[model samples]
Target: MSNSAYRWMVAVPAFVVVAAFGVYLGTTHGAPTALDRSVMDTVTGLRTPTLTSVIKDVTVIFSPVAVTIWTALLAAVLVWRDRSLVRALPVVATVAAAGIVGEAIKLAVSRPRPPAIDQLGAVEATYSYPSGHVMGTTALVAAAVSVCAASVGARVAAGCLAAATVVVCAATRLYLGAHWVTDVLAAICVGVGVALVVPVVLAAVIGRLAPHLPAWVGVPAANAGSKA
Candidate 1:
């Protein structure tokens, strides 16, 4: 099999494993238990005045606005370096696809958020099988990493940043009582699966368009320094 074929083969099994694991967790842990309550309370307790205020501010501040800003920044870098538009296309497309997929999965699962009547009061009525915040940030970070993967340092930094982003986003979701731990985990799996596929697809597109573009166009190193 070719490299692309190998990638797809790996991705398919990986996605299946993630989905199956998510289903297993969802079914086996249908409802929040005392342990869940204890854990949630612990997280909540750690939400000191400063931390709580920061979380609230950061969560609200980093909404779609931050996404847009980052996206534009990435695009600007590509455009500034006169890279092929094809190379930058995937960044936007993957993020959008992830959002849509996240919503669809949430609807299909139809898992309700943790009961508001319990310790952490509910805030929204949407299905919570997968967390949108986690999915969104995951997609963004993944796209950024893909665009910067040509260099060893870039790859390492991207991996670290992506991991940290996922953790922080997942923690924020749970602390805010917007989702159950299981839901966030499911979202991470789903987001990761999508993130893995998107860059490969974009790479193929860029490869095909490479001949038609200038020598500098689509050079991965050229855009490596740009924030994703």
Candidate 2:
């Protein structure tokens, strides 16, 4: 199959699943599902002072501020290395768009965090149908992997690393009771969708504009920075 076709195959189902799931959660009026409660129960049951402290530290590492700073640094490094703004646009755009999309869905769903009893790290005051932390990390890692993984073995390794990073971010949210199980899952879906769509769309736009632009932009073609 064509690359674009494969991307759509993966991205479309993700968006559709998240949309339906979001609607279901929205209508619940912040009530946790049986599965949500079950998972939270398990997570809360496993909590210890040491583990909680460790997870709280992990929370700080994946906080919105930290994620944004690291994402910006990554984009800057990529742009500097490639000497092409187009090369790093996908990572930056994917992460930014994921944050926006995740926030919007959170607001629309208006789901509350798990009960105070389950909250271990810090209290969050925002709607919580989707964990923005997971979304941001997921998008950042996925976009970076797409840009950097060129060989089959490299792509496989990068894919595993991206998955592990996303899982850790999601786990931090759950372990701290910052989000219900669905929230992190939905964030992953949304993040993946944004990561998948943004690069191709950006590449197409840059490809169309490449001829009109000056040579200094370093975008010579649609696939300049991206690997096939």
Candidate that scores best on lDDT: 2
Q: What is the Å distance of residue 140 in model 1 from its true position?
A: 0.9
Q: Score residue 180 of candidate 1 by CA lDDT.
A: 75
Give the per-residue lDDT of model 1 (tens digit) for 1-228: 664566567567756765675576468554665666676777767766677667766665335557667777877776665445544666776777788887877665566777674223336777776778887777778777766566778789779988997898788778877777767776777777776677677666667777897765563321333444
**Poorly placed runs, candidate 2 (over 4 Å):** 220-228
Tens digits of per-residue lDDT for model 2, 100-218: 88888877888887877778755777888788888888888888887777787887898899899888888889988889998888888998888888877877887778889875564
Clashing pairs in 2: none
The per-residue C-alpha lDDT of model 2 at residue 219 equals: 49
TM-scores for all candidates: the values are 0.76, 0.93
Model 1 whole-model lDDT (C-alpha atoms)? 0.68
- Against the hidden true structure, what lDDT does model 2 obtain? 0.81
